[model samples]
Target: MRRKQDKNIENKQREEETIPKKISYAEILELKKPDERKLFLRKTFLLIGLILFVLSIILFVFINTLVGLGLFLLSIWVISKYWTLQDHLLRESVYFHPKYQEFRETPTKKIQFFNFSFSRFIATVIMISLIIWNINTFGLELGHVGDTGHWWNLGALTWAYPLAIPLAILSLGLVGYIVIHPNLTIIYESENLYHIYEIRLFSPWLTEIPKNNIEAIRLHNSKNGPQWLYAVILFYIILLFKSGIALIEHPFQTNYIHSVHLIITASLTLLSIIILIAKQHCYFEIVTSDRLYEMWFDPALLHKRKMENIANFFCIEPIARDQHGFFDPLPKKSVNYDDQTRELLISTSRSYFRLCFGLFLIFIGIYSIFSYSLLGEFTAYTCLSYGFIVFFKGIKEDFSDKNNIIIEIDRENKQFKQKRIFSRILEYHFFNNLKSLQLHENTDKSPQYYPPKLDIFDIAGVIAIIFFIVQEYVYQIMVWAPKNIDFQNILVMLFELSIIITLIYLIIRPVDTINVGTKTIDNYIIQLPSLFRYSEKNGERNNFILSNVYKSKETKSFIKKRIILIIITISISAIIAVIDIFQFLP
Candidate 1:
């Protein structure tokens, strides 16, 4: 028996010169989803955020009374308007689709995980183990249970026997369920249709997209912040380790074979360093007409046969940038547009973890300042502006240079149309006019020590001068100082030296540039710091150019001059070193 086709589905099939089994509903209606762009939430995060938010409101209201009322209303407005954390879209319990005639269809294939896996279970266990390890890193005294002595270590759960133990037990149940099930995906497919079923903690509902509705599949690297920051962190960790060893100058090599807390902190730092080294940028992105599906995986570990199967099954090519993050372009004689304009849909959605963290920090900072710290003292120093800085950084991920885009390339008409929905930006260009435009790509050498905010050498000179100055005073005066003072002062002086060294190290970092400009146009260059690649035919591109990451010289000379600081610090240091060596000064 033949299935009935809906109007919208029928029309799509008819255009492609093929007919599909009909359905009662004409068009596949996409359910309205949560505004996931602004806020962040996963399984248990929303509850935690809600509790923190309530606590903050209570503290403010109790203290400010009248003013707190207005602040509360403002908070409500702000949260609702922008960053109100919400849960993932929970799909309906059931769905309507083509009948389950798996045996009847030709070449009916069911593809998913090669087998059930405990990878997720293992990862979850490791994460929870780390959490418990850190929890016990510091000393704690849990209150006594009846006449019993204080609970120690893992026994701390007994203090809150009523709620804590119950909650812990409930958490264990959830973890057990997750460990058993993990996340599963099953895609049932034939020559004409694809039915996808995803079983995840957050994505429990199963559904499918129309086969013809699939627009494109893109591959992206999860590259992060500037190189300078990475270098700084690496050096800082090394310096800290050195400092710790210096603190225990005695024979204590095996003491910490160290604190559990120090071990925990070191483990976290090492994890961060490992992330810095292995930048996991490979995510296979599948964009449908109305929705997007993503699989974040390490490309190196992805099965080659499976990847080929996906490509062959979809009847489409996967678009990815070259290692440098550029794309191969298309030729002049592109597909005949006829009466059709090949439309390209591009996504600019980013991870929202930072944005959520920033908002949470703002709430915590406000509560801390209002409840405990003096408003007058805080206002005077203004040192707590970091919360705002983090907030801005978080938002930057969303409102970056490249917004979600829809492009129509009419090579037949030699025309191009670009539009961004959220930004309401529209532009028109011509392919012929762009013929002379070469894709401009530039990359820097390996990451170095400092940012390109200023000249790196100048910063170095300044540090040198400051170090000599601090040392000269110590050398000249330490003759009369006690042994303890001398030792302590030397440590303090080295500490001061490290700070200056970092300051200059940051100033002198290299900054390469990437830009898009036309020789035919005026002095116009749009920096492509955030742009990975551009091509006329995005899906089936041929000619190519790309970059992974690039820092610009544009912001390097913001202050324009570091000469005075460099010259003064360097000259003073050099003169003192020379004089001391020659014993020219007493």
Candidate 2:
């Protein structure tokens, strides 16, 4: 009986695993003829071309006349081609999927109202206010006979002031139109589930998902804080440019420019506030499943196919105490989702705009360095110093690998050895025994995991030497002196050289030891006198003595070297200083 039950369950599972067939577009457009679709595309193309042509004409007439007119016609031609290509692609897509139909048979009533009222009102208000402000401040200049000492006196502002406002208004209106349009739709249907999307002019349309198609549903944050901040800064800069133009055109009309500035500043400031509010509310949430995922921002939401998604979902783990009663591990878990998902978040966050802003800043920095005489040398020195230090540190660490030596004592013999081991050595032993040895691997723990051969003092000395060299070069290039180099500079250089030499000697010294066995013995009792002392009594081992050999002969040699170098360095510095002082006095 149990066997029969298990067989039934297995059969049911197999039946449930069947994949659903996708719908085709040809079935969807069967209600309308091919000729009608072609006609509709033609009209859309013509409309788009006409709009582009009109915009071009207006811009051309207002700006450079002939050049404007030429560009205007060219833009119209380009827009026409763009529309035709878009139409062709859309038709091709629809033909390939005949069964696939739009989610909505008719446009939503809410969208129509939004388009006619809210969008139009906002656009009109913005357009009218901009026109009024520009005319009152800059338009008056065309009729004025005398110079008003305004930025209108400048050629660029004179041309830009009239063109920018209308263009901005037009862009806003277009965005609004895209949001409100209702004919566009997306449909998703499965064996048991159905999804429908009514596409508006403002955002992409999405369809419903089949329950079986969903693999797993997970939450994701799409907002990139850094990218958002960069975008805000960029917009602020653009507004500042507009304000600059206004300032140039009407130098005396501070009130008009100030108002414009206030408006732009307020809008941007409000946007930042909104972003902060959203972050507090966790406004960026993405619901991802196997078949599809939906990204929801405050004002907009989008759904994309699972195959077409690309996003980086960071899995943030909450703080937890380990068995050792210590809270240490805190790391974000991350995975790369599909590219479509990533792009969706990136587009909404205005990540590309942020990148452009970064590029702009880099260009500005470069320009400032080259164009400003006062900053040229300082910038050059700073960049050179940073580059040299980083390069030297990398090279020193790489070369110091040869200095690392690991000695493994037999487990049985470890009890016989007696030495006051340094804390560093103890740590090295603990890590080597407890954790897997990571020599060349660049893992998360690599930075903390010290290689066996490299000594701490050697590393420190190398760093110090690099710093001294860099400083010496900088002094040579920047500071001017008499026929003889400055005594202070010479002193600094000599002191650095002395330290480097001392460090080198300390690193190269051999390990000290003493043998305790007779000449005939093959395995002599090798006693490391610096670290340990063992006594043999009645042919048996007695108490083992331990010593801190690190501070003995090897350390003394290093210290002596340092002292000698310091004295020599000081003498050289003193001689140079005396020469410099005498030369000045003469």
Candidate 3:
């Protein structure tokens, strides 16, 4: 009986050792009601605070600068108090203490929610981005000209000075709103559910993932030590190379540029090297897959032991590692993707139409603006319209997330799917039914599987073509056409009609490339930036489906014509501008 009891005790200890550490943030915090109402109040306060802060800055610009400063400080103080109050409410909850990371353990000895706090990494990013984006604008507006006649807009006394206060408020408001939200990566209690809870102003955003569905947990460190160190060293070496060049080029010319470069490079080299990495901001991730999920994370966040326990608890197969002992970046498409199926991440697509149109509009706008209002009101209106057009188009291109397309190719199922982020539609096709995919470089946006759409740019092109045709026709009728009713007049009229038809064709060129009535198979067009850098080949852009399609003859022909047109148009307009006002810049 004693021996049996000892064996049972040993078994119990083994079971205890095997039991995975599961964290339940909600249960541990004893959160009862949905925090939506609470969050609503918090969001309202933040919005109001931001507006007031901006108002103070505006007041500062109009009134005395000191008055504006005082008001802004007051607004800032009020906002800070409100944030502190909001955090106080979060901390005062029954289970969670104000101190930080309070947790409650279950009877089974499972410790739930070791702790959750605001992410310092996120806060740091917000601060950095705000400073970088607004610095130039501030310099442009508020800065005074140097004694040597060097000028900048550095917020000196311009109306833009007021804008800085509001911008600061906006930045702080955003950081407070987002960074103060708790980070809950994974929380699980029983066999029934697993969840990731992020507390936001909207409420607790809880994504409950089923137990069997979770494939693997991997680590990603934002502050990659070795990579950062290498970059800093490379930057210093480049600076050193430049200094050497400067010494060779102007050995006796002492304007402080050479000395500045050398001093900065030398000062940073050692410090960047020996900051000996610590406290990484880590993101644990895995591709959302129906099969075994593959992920890689920093070992600091979830060590091998924790990974093994989690895998065992969830009944997941041990994540396979490559020969170098690193997790395989691309998970096998098959149970063993040896030969049956192949998955490829489609990377890099640029819209040549957008590019060409953007450049074309900017060219037109510059010419109109600098034409000295030669066409009077017509030139003024055109210049005004183009200003808005150029600004909006730039914002749409540079700031927008065009890389939200996710494609999945299931060779086993003979299926091709294109799914976009935040989109409900799943566009799919049969693999054998599809024939070709256009592969284009990032700089080469002319190649596309489908014809481009008709937009304002197309209309503008048509209008310009028509205007030129009209001008030519008027010139011919007044100067070249004989003042007699004869066969020549009929021929002239026919020529004008032909010009209209040609202009119409040019207007619809982008749209007419793809004939809807044709039975040709389409190549899936996936647009990305720096395609291979974040590709299935390198293993970074793992969330999307993958395929690498070589350039096709049909696509190539279309792209070649389109590119030649872009080039010719750009060259012609650029030459005109150079003659018209290359002085526009100087």
Report lDDT (Cα) of residue 313, candidate 3.
45
Ranking by lDDT: 1, 3, 2
Q: Which ten residues in a row have the lowest lDDT in candidate 1?
A: 424-433
Q: Each prediction's Cα lDDT score?
A: 0.39, 0.34, 0.38
Candidate 2: tens digits of C-alpha lDDT, residues 1-586: 9999999999998785443344444543342233555657667767777776787777767766787677677767765654444332222222222235443222222111111223333434554455455455545444334232333454334322543454355446545654553334343334333343443444444444333323222222322222222222323333444454555567566445444544554354334323332231011222222223443322222221111121111111111222332321111111112211111000000012223322433343334344542223333233222222222222221121211212222122111111111111110110001111111112222111111132333343234333434444444434443445777757645654554454343333323232112122222222121211222222121222223233334336655664565456445544554555566653
lDDT of 3 at 347: 28
- Runs in model 2 with CA error above 4 Å? 1-132, 140-143, 146-194, 201-221, 224-586
lDDT accuracy of residue 498 in candidate 3: 60
TM-score of each: 0.35, 0.29, 0.30
Clash count, one per candidate: 21, 34, 24
- Measured with C-alpha atoms, the lDDT of residue 550 in candidate 2 is 38
Per-residue lDDT tens digits for candidate 3, residues 244-313, read 3555457565455434434443343323322222223233443222322222232334433443344344
Error of 3 at 476 (Å): 39
lDDT of candidate 1 over 1-586, digit per residue (tens): 1344577677877775443343222233322345364234332344454554575588676766656566556555544533333322222222323344221123357766432223333433544554465344432345334322223344453322321232244336537755444455566674543556656653433444445544444433322323113323333333334444443554644444233333344445545433433342223545454556665432223444444445445533322222443422322222344534333434343434435544543454344344543122222112123223334333432333343433334444333333222221111121222222212322322111112332342343235435544444455354434444566656645654554454443344222211212223322222111223334335342222222222334333432345455656656766665667568445
**Against the hidden true structure, what lDDT does model 3 obtain?**
0.38
- Rank the candidate models, highest TM-score first: 1, 3, 2
